[model samples]
Target: MPTEAAFSWPREFVWGVSTSSYQIEGAVAEDGRAPSIWDTRCRMAGKIANGDSGDVACDHYHRYPQDVALMRELGIGAYRFSVAWPRVLPRGRGQVNEKGLDFYDRLIDAVLAAGIEPWLCLYHWDLPQALDDLGGWTNRDCAGWYADYAALIARRFGDRVQRWATFNEFSVFTLFGYAIDWSAPGVTDRDAHLRAIHHVNLAHGLGVGVLRDLLPQASIGAIHNRQVVWPEQDCDADRAAAALLDEHWNRAFPDPQLLGHYPPQIAAAIEPYVRGGDMATICRRLDWFGLNHYGPIFAKADPQCTWNFAWGEAPADAPRSALGWPTWPAAFRDELIDLSRRYRLPIYVTENGAGGSDSVGADGAVDDPARVAYLRDYTGALREALQAGADVRGYFVWSLLDNFEWGSGYGPRFGLVHVDYTTQQRTPKTSFGWYRAFIRDARG
Candidate 1:
């Protein structure tokens, strides 16, 4: 490992950007695409901010060529994107949608033609409504359904798309969707949350097995968002609260995947709710682990808080993003280093970016220096972690363009390129130029 003073990425380091289908693809009902849970949820009253939806998000489904051109111009080596399940299996199981498969056929070809590798994520919370109506992630059978879908995608596009992520942020989807009722197919029952979590874990393992069987040479993995839970005070009570927070947020899903066992604390907490063999199903081995990190959580012992711990209100003097997340780069480095040591898997910064309110200036350019600073500082943190012996192989910025941000809608922009929703125009922000320059320097 390089020491702190001599830290730098390998010459072939992968520089990439990531985006999801439901967040960017749009054309929800076109080309034989069917409704996803997200589509159904956004139509519900008051479910999303400004009553906004991703019905026509950036028209990436129609304009991917231009997007690929942008990636090529930015000197990026890879593009991490998700495929919509409903797009491929319109009703989520029985029949395959040729049109849906064709769309991705073009997409993968476009990325390769641009000399960029396509990293495909099989699921990104856009489950087909047909599946959710029957049972969704809460149903064990959904695991088999997901595996079938994964098999189809791998057989169809595996030759071109060498990197595959089985699921994107399973904890977020399970907790927010079931426990908090803030995301799609919203349910607010703890039992449902526990069930969903189990099914998602099983799906990951089953999906990986399918991908490996079908695309034997492909690199298969999952993207899980891991956060550092720090106590507000060093007291025993505070430390205990922090431990619980960590079990729920960071270790719950990964522990099972990497170690084949749930955290003892989490298992005890949910013991009354768990059924037999659920833990074993979640302990699937993975080829790689994608770490989607943003900021740290400072928790305090609080019985009143939903999860038995509370995140103190945004600090009075700290800088925050449009999403109100603290701007802290140190957390990024620490989290990566810790995860690298604990998991012992090749790591990828699958997602990291701040949400900001950006607009095209009168000069026809977006001067997002704040975003530039965020990227620079965060990249420096990544370098620091590498110096400390983290086996990080790549960094994929959170987004390439501003698209739907789930419950928050499009209100918060987390893109290097600004998207004018009404006009569907893409304008590269100053941060985009900075990233391009960084990639050039890293390559040099």
Candidate 2:
């Protein structure tokens, strides 16, 4: 364990919190916002936990000013949020929603007024249901549609927001949505999976080009969720599963986008979708690498699934968070160091935190000691990575408020502030104070 005195950061290091459009902003139908794939998925029976949907999630759509005030008081230097594709483009392409664009314009102005920089992420897995109707990322035309949407956002908010992320966690969405039935637009077909993989990479590269062209002064990057993968057992089958899972989960996105070639396991499989000059289009220059890591994952052979590998469990004795995710700060440390060496760009830990089942206590206080411990341990490892020469420039916690957590719905709380779903109240947890003080001391 590192002492508080040992954990120090440079003055230029950025500290922020991240939240997505679908996860936080409710008001799905208001302001001409059409249905997203997630909206459709939530309507399906037994898709989301407790049958909960994002219909009224935290009500951030109407209460963003209050959220910005909360962030100002927390003393963060930046706020990273996403724009809902369906909200901006309604049916995904032809028509523009001025009301939807106006909402973000207001939100961005409020954030800037509070003296906090805003990092705009274009996509966070909320594909317009209209696009999914046309086969979503499984079709190559989807990339061009995404680029047009990017141009609209750039022309509207480019002057105010200089920090841009093309997409967040590409592997997690493509893998879960296409290969497994765990996410929205769930389809378990190999061709669909391969097409999605190639088209998304193409979209990212196109989005990056658009941002660079429109916002010449902007800093651009794409967020990837990378974690070490381990086999559940010592057998050959488990090892093979772990290896393949690692390639898909870790190497699929960054390997192609940064290195200009797909991973060995996916190279031949995705070749059918590749055309002349496609590799060049998929490997645009990025200013930084955004990493959203929780911890290492364990893989086991599963003959029943489309990918043939299933999520395995950690040993019963390993340290874990309230959500049963393994708590290994060393893995976080190693990931930062390895990412720095591999990509050769400034790195930002865009999202790193734990999830817990927190409830407001009787005294009107949220005392989450586990969350504080998790942040402390992870940040300690982060400092170690810095000392070992990882070119890390920023660190943003997973979220600012506990909103919708995908298929798990609102069960896992990964927020520094606790949000009451009924009243839409925001209460800063004990970890919030810890982070505020930590940032103050480090930056001072």
Candidate 3:
């Protein structure tokens, strides 16, 4: 028998699945839409797995109504999706593309018609290629640029959209895309990373102000992947290394956004970029706090490094996802408890799901028992934290369908519903049925 999650929630809690535009909506050339950084990066040789460019991945751009129907059938209360920057302001600034905006207008309408609340995320790392030409996130001008874009969308969709988020996973976009060569705008500059950090936070602060002013009745927040920080082993160096990384990856954004300043450890490293009043702008009052946690990343000290730390792998004996992420539910619970107590805001598990080797079985249905188990364990742990007084308000699965998985491409599946890339067929796996039952049972 499957281990059912003994969890309950308030009647008004937000429950849904999360998806980003670049990952699922695959009409790269349609609607006068300008190319995003991911679109440009995908075409480069050896960038994505199987040379996939999301050119035709899942074709959700054309098939969103069917996808919305899936959400409705799953009995979820909300749907969180991102608006592609290039799709709205194709050039990322000047003229707004009416046709591109029309697509989202239709998507939000469909979601509303299905009786599902639309939780809109302003940016999800799909910066316009044109904006990349203008120094992208590293450019201080991006703060105003993003604020303008936020105002445009909040004005357009605020009527139907009940919840809003500034950006999804700030650390990932800055560190992976800027500091490392794995993601789009692929570069390896420490100074650029430091600069981009403050700029992105500035954009968030400005974006939050736009949402608050335009959508005063709606709840506003930002999604961050600030999970449990741990050391590689019981060693002084590793513990020290973990502290620095925790300061950078975990506290760097939220502290300034919530507490009005950076953690002392990395403050000097990024002080050059911190102009006057930037911290005040970053620490906007949020109605809720969005946390995306999978598991813990243990850090190890390294002498020859400027950052002085390296990402050490999780314990080998632990349950592992197909993407090799540690499936540690205790860490998930710890994070939920920590955030609820520290942030003092209604916590939402914005993105939490395991990446699995999902496939369409010979019988034509997808079988992903591991993902079902992963979700069960993690949510059970979330329930335990809630029972122990964590003010966790809701949980949204990482994705609704398997589309682009970023640098790892489409190889890792993180969706309850499996997507056959070739046929654009959507098959709800075992986890889908499990989630549906769980929601139905919890609500009842």
Q: Which is better, 2 or 3, measured by TM-score?
A: 2
Model 1 lDDT per residue over 105-139, tens place = 99999999999999999999999999999989888
- Indicate whether candidate 1 or candidate 3 has the larger lDDT: 3
- Which order, best to worst by TM-score? 2, 3, 1
Model 2, 1-444: lDDT tens per residue? 456576667879999999999999999999899999999999999999999999999899999999999999999999999999999899999989999999999999999999999999999999999999999999999999999999999999998999999999999999999999999899989899999999999999999999988888899999999999999888999999999999899999999999999999889888888999999999999999999999889999999988899999898888999888998999999999999999999999999999999999999989889989999999988999998889999999988999899999999999999999999989999889999998898887
| Full-model lDDT, candidate 2 | 0.94
Cα deviation of 366, candidate 2, in Å: 0.3
TM-score to native of every candidate shown: 0.95, 0.98, 0.96
Q: What is candidate 3's lDDT per residue for 1-444, written digit by digit as tens?
A: 123355456777777999999999988889888899999999899988888787777888899999999999999998999999998899999999998889999999999999998999998999999999999988999899999999999989888888899999998888778766788888778888898899999999999888888888889999999877789888999999999889888998888899888899778889988888888888899999999988888889986554778788777797787667887898888888888888899999999999988888899988888888889999889878888789988999988999899877889999989998888889999999999998997787
Report per-prediction Cα RMSD to one decimal: 2.0, 1.4, 2.4
Total clashing residue pairs per candidate?
Answer: 0, 0, 1
Instruction: Give the alpha-carbon lDDT of every model.
Output: 0.87, 0.94, 0.88
